[model samples]
Target: MNSRHIYHVDLAPVLGSTFQPTGFPDVGAATFTRFEGGQKVDALLVESVQSMANRLEATAWDSAADRPVDAVAGLPWVRVVRAGSAEFLTSSRLEAHRLASPFVHKATVDGRPMLDVIKEKLGLAKDTPLNRSAMARAVAGLDPFCLVHGVFFSHKEWLGQPKFARASSAVIEAHDVLRAISGGRKSDRVRHQLGEDVGGTAEGYGSVPFHRTEWTAKRIVASFVVDGELLRSYGLPEPVADLLETLALWEIRVLLTGGLRLRTACDLDVVSEVEARRGPALPELDELTGRLRELIGQCGEVFGDGEPLTVEWSSGKKG
Candidate 1:
């Protein structure tokens, strides 16, 4: 099997409720009662902190400490969790933590807005506010949810076994739906219109020269199809194909949340590695194609089919 490194990161928004030093309202009441009954809350607090610290240390040391530095460094899977004030590096302690630290400006993971990250990563002018808005609008116009699905489908092995197949199916189904919607035509005008409709741009929205209409829905859909094929070429089960798509979508979410957007080609390489590992499974493409077609047919039946022409017309009308 092609062994590739996969990184999964989750950034959970912190609510006021979670920040309370005490567990919760009920827990606080229980603690008060315990105090009234002469029980020590200090001991409990100490135990809880100790447990948390131990868990953190264990997680940090889990894979990095035992494996050779070069081997661990090159392995594909990496996961980082950013929740509230704490950042947890689930896979590689050194690398994951290093990548995560930049996000932590001051006490909070610099929620400077995902747009800023996009601008910086893409090398947009610092003072170009209107251009930034236009770029942001363009991205927001595409189906944001599918980006995560794409990531999952592109990186199947990273997903736990139990969820592998179902996740793959969902992504493949979504891909079929998107493809049918786009009619396989990649038009800059169509993409620009999608960005305007989905992202809401104003008349004066200065255009970011790098922001092309082609970066919208059609490109994403095309990437999904290519990634799906690549996964199938790996002799990975349909489930794995689906999982990588989901991971792609997830990576999009993470990038967006961090105020960033990725080049389509940049992400495509991330997905294509699976196929590169074992070489092309082109001889098996016919079987894979048939399975995907069957999956698409089943999905249409379940989700309610419409004439592709009619759907395209409706999309145009809506746009």
Candidate 2:
């Protein structure tokens, strides 16, 4: 009765103890508004996925050669430059909101409309009736740039907003705790390095705001509610579903690796009704990593001859 579908996850970050605080200006250091704080956490999660996407941009099937292709050939998904909409994942689906459609009447990255660029790249006639769907799929097939990174992070609530983020289902609660971080004191700076009058007042750059984190120790952690039932309903292949879950977890792993003063919960509390009695409560990530290899094994041919490969979607621990 083991269901690989992940239903819920609980994570608690031990800041100051091991990891320092991690706060941002968007939500402010002392923001108490739930919505605003949620928005900030949502933004972080979304961008983190984009970061993962950037790291994993190399996955595409070359239709011409009937084989896998290079990263430059296409990304695993699209990332609409700065002006394009961004994507966010939730507990049940993926959602998107247009940042700004400035490209509506203007050209993007070139002196032509996006359709024209896609047409030229695909070697299609300018007059070809490339509808919106066709155009999107075409662009995704070739570059995935227009698809927005991590759009494949589906099975959330399918919710989105323009100025605010919507992560109701996935994130039940989030905490951004502040703490005293270690750093250069103004007196230390003036005495050792910049003798007096660095800032013309013996303050130097040590006392500047934003330049140094006032609250050096910050902890950002959240409790999530995932639904394996909903996740499994997406109808994707088992490996692919697991891959998405793995990558989503990997995004956190990448951001919270043991470094700097930012410590995070490496061990995530995983609870699934599938392994109800005792199984799903604590599943090993190593098992999932082993499964991701099927993808590599299937495409090792395109991977230049005699190259040692290590496909690591690294993250840690279980709470």
Candidate 3:
């Protein structure tokens, strides 16, 4: 069977002020709609490419159209930016596209399609279209490890968290095993203190930390074993397994950081007990909220439903 192809596009550059004339807006304040099987599911506001470009264009044209030609000349030139792109091939629909794309396509992961796994695991109807709402809920409910690892693998950094260092180490370790396995080489140790196959160690046993704080060369080996076990258990392909590991790391960071932005608008002057009951402080609260909301909305426009040029939805869910 042919593997499914998943594509990732970075919309940051396309949603910038320079792309405004092309109808992109500031992504933070746009509403997003997710669709499955041509039906709408869940919707949310997020930062998207289209919204960001549109907003920037509108602001410039509305305020500067009538200004003197020379006055506008001093303004900064706008340009569309392209962040990065990656492609993966897998068997499972959910695993193929995973969270990497705005839409999902039917594919196999570990020799089984995602739809089949969903039916087996979640008891979802075979004929049902994975709509946005359902998919979003599923993603939200995914094992924090899988979700965080996926995110981490895609990008080296998340909100300033250092995940690349760990991922790079894992990749190198995996490569070593792949090479040794291909070479029919045998070592004396059973399970090395690490999770990998040592010359003389037992199967499925290794010493390493499962959490990020435990990350180390030995832990990397253990992580590899854990990854293999997860792949076999979940029927995920090697690529998908790697993606999940990265995402798991990212999730940990997100959880540790709380939400995307810190709440810096706390009140002062009141006693501790009274202050706890109070809401955000004045202008700063309003300003930060507005900015975040705007950015999220823009994200929605770029990746949301209802746009023909946009990607299709997999299981119903809004990011």
Candidate 4:
């Protein structure tokens, strides 16, 4: 399908009406007005697209196990390990840039640098037509998440740095927002005399108080969209395409069920069922998980040997 799959869900604060929205360094809360129908409505950005992307990926990883969760157990990814030991470091699944991450590309796999391996596998050469389908397939073999979340290999040595826009993206926003101002104090129990060696505020010797601004919103919404057109453009096989889309849906399900704690004060819960704005209704989580396992098996050949492609990182190497 060339059309996009768009979904939206209503959300509410887990505790109370007042919740904290993401803030910038000096801008405080990002509040603005947008027209809905014919009237202007106050709006606040709960979470940005970039932040939501990170959250979505987090749902697929099990930090305690240092691997993909059960739902995505069979996906291929590059893993970086400490040199002289099998100690886990990082992986394409967790890295923001996926295969393009310095920790992946700058390290060595099977005695060959990953960057060089990428070039050799993709068969990149100057003055040659960029075979985007081949590039997509190659990346899919390394890390399918890169296909779903998108990636850009921007190293100077990489000829025609391949870049793919995110096939799935999401953002959380609130409407009819009201500011809730609060404050807290960091009290120093000990008092210091003028002649004492105790230092100033910078040395944690003084009581510091700070003002906090939260928000009370009439309604909050988390919107997700999967670009079917862009996904098809990758020219991936049907099974691979289905796997990526299912992974995207699974991420949304997990995030809404448990990963909505954006910050200490920004906890949220999905108040209503995930409503589809386009395409078909989302499948049940159990169904999706089962399908994922089957698809992983069907697409096994496209992925690297079942084991992760390990990169041995040594000291003094810049990554």
Best candidate according to lDDT:
4
Q: Supply the TM-score for candidate 3.
A: 0.19
Residue-level lDDT tens digits of model 1 in 195-303:
5445533443333233311111111111111244433443433443344343333333222233211222222212221222222322233343344344434332212
At residue 231, candidate 2 shows an lDDT of 33
Q: Each candidate: how many clashes? A: 35, 20, 80, 0
Question: What C-alpha lDDT, on a 0 to 100 scale, does residue 33 get in candidate 1?
Answer: 13
Which of candidates 3 and 4 reaches a greater lDDT?
A: 4
What is candidate 3's lDDT per residue for 189-247, written digit by digit as tens? 44555533343234534443332110111000001111323323343433433333333
Sorting all predicted structures by lDDT, with the top scorer first, yields: 4, 2, 1, 3
Please write out the lDDT profile of model 2 over residues 107-186, one tens digit for every residue: 24333444334335434443354243433333334322223332221111211210111111222222343433455434
Q: Which runs in model 3 stand beyond 4 Å of their true positions?
A: 1-105, 126-137, 141-319
The per-prediction CA RMSD against the true structure, in angstroms, equals: 27.9, 13.4, 26.9, 1.9
Error of 4 at 96 (Å): 1.5
Compute the lDDT for candidate 1: 0.25
Alpha carbon lDDT of residue 259, candidate 3?
A: 24
The better-scoring model by lDDT among 2 and 3 is 2
TM-score of each: 0.17, 0.37, 0.19, 0.94
Show model 1 residue runs off by greater than 4 Å: 1-226, 261-319
Q: Kindly list the per-residue Cα lDDT of model 4 for residues 47-87, writing each as its tens digit.
A: 99988999999999999999888778778888899878999
Q: Which residue pairs show backbone clashes in model 4?
A: none
